[model samples]
Target: MSNILRIATFNVHKGLSTFNARFSLHDQRELLRKLHADIVFLQEVQDEHAKHSKRFSPFPLNGQLEFLADAVWPNYSYGKNSVYPAGHHGNAVLSKFPIINTENRDISAHSVEQRGMLHCEISIPGWDQTLHCICVHLGLFARWRTKQLQEVKRFIEDHVPADSPLIIAGDFNDWSLNAGRSFAESLHLREVFEHSHGKPAQSFPSWLPILRLDRIYTRGFSIRHVEVHTGPTWLKVSDHAVLTATLAHQTA
Candidate 1:
């Protein structure tokens, strides 16, 4: 059995291209399949959008999480953060392993921006300990994001074990790099890109990524490789490019 795990995170922009001109969930699904990630953390996933279904003939009858998961990732969980008359959207996690439990926590600092953390406890076939995965989407403002980070810390302290394997991935919206330091100091977790290459990966504006907006942080795992997928296809798929990391459990 392989001990190494492949993980990825992406903000799908609600299955639409920049400015909502291109509605192409199929393209996003195809690109995700090519990544072959064992675990995927998604932000801006549409749980239900009645209007979109009517507008786009190809929109899956099921939610975007189910459509993207397909057959590869059978176990998945979605957290609804923002709700409207049309529908709701939020964070989602798709895992190849069994998801034993899940919870969606509303972490929004204010009413203006709805955000959430989709926490999932997963059991690998042969692993002795369960893994905790949190798919996060923080606020746009620094102060609000700081508050949300504290909430995240509190959530972990209250629910997750200290020594358990933990993975947190998604769009942080912290372009100033403040969140990284906070997480490192509080949770003792290492960001995958920083651990691998000494700095966070820039993943915003997929076409010409210049902002470090997405990230993956882990505890009890050693980073082997980290990549920020870009180029034409990735650019067209979503406004934010995909972030991937290869990691293995630390030897005892």
Candidate 2:
């Protein structure tokens, strides 16, 4: 029985939706397989739409989430949020372990922006417990994001068990920094990336990495190892870099 839990979070930019290239899910499967995480939280995943598929090529005929999951994580769940003429896009959780419960919560307090948090309760072998994993993607504006964060807090309080190991991660879009820390403290959750390292990783704008937006956070887990996957392989995958971590439950 393996007690070590490997988790990773990434904003896949709708499978690298580059208007110019329009390759369509190109390299996403390959890239994710390389990460080899036990559980994965993905932001900006598309379901299916031939129009959009044609517009993007490497993966045109398959549901974006299914395609990626089939190749990488076989057992997974996706929560659709923003539905537009382009297609429906949202968050997804892929797990190698048994998923006992799952829900997709709408955290978009602002009607103007579409956002979501995909929560999944997974039963890992050897952990002797279930873990609450929430995959989040917040709004663009600070005010809207703040309200959304509060909503997220309420959601967690109402749904997730307090005693269960809690992991909330994804593209927070909080380049400013303070907001994330404030929210984490309020929820009694620890930001694993920041605790292990010095700060949240610079993940957005994968080309330049100006903003420290993407993060992997765990509230009840003791941080073991934290890694930000950068360099050439990541640059071709998405607009945001991936955050990976190895964690242990806080000991008594």
Top TM-score model: 1
What C-alpha lDDT does candidate 2 achieve relative to the native structure? 0.80
Question: What total of clashing residue pairs does each candidate reach?
Answer: 0, 3
**lDDT of each prediction vs. the true structure?**
0.90, 0.80
Candidate 1, pairs of clashing residues: none
Specify the highest-lDDT model's number.
Answer: 1
The residue ranges of model 2 lying beyond 4 angstroms of the native Cα positions read 17-20, 232-235
Global lDDT of model 1: 0.90
Question: TM-score of each candidate?
Answer: 0.97, 0.93
Model 2, 117-158: lDDT tens digits are: 888989877775688998999988999789988888898899
Model 1 scores a TM of 0.97
Off by over 4 Å in 1: none
TM-score of 2: 0.93
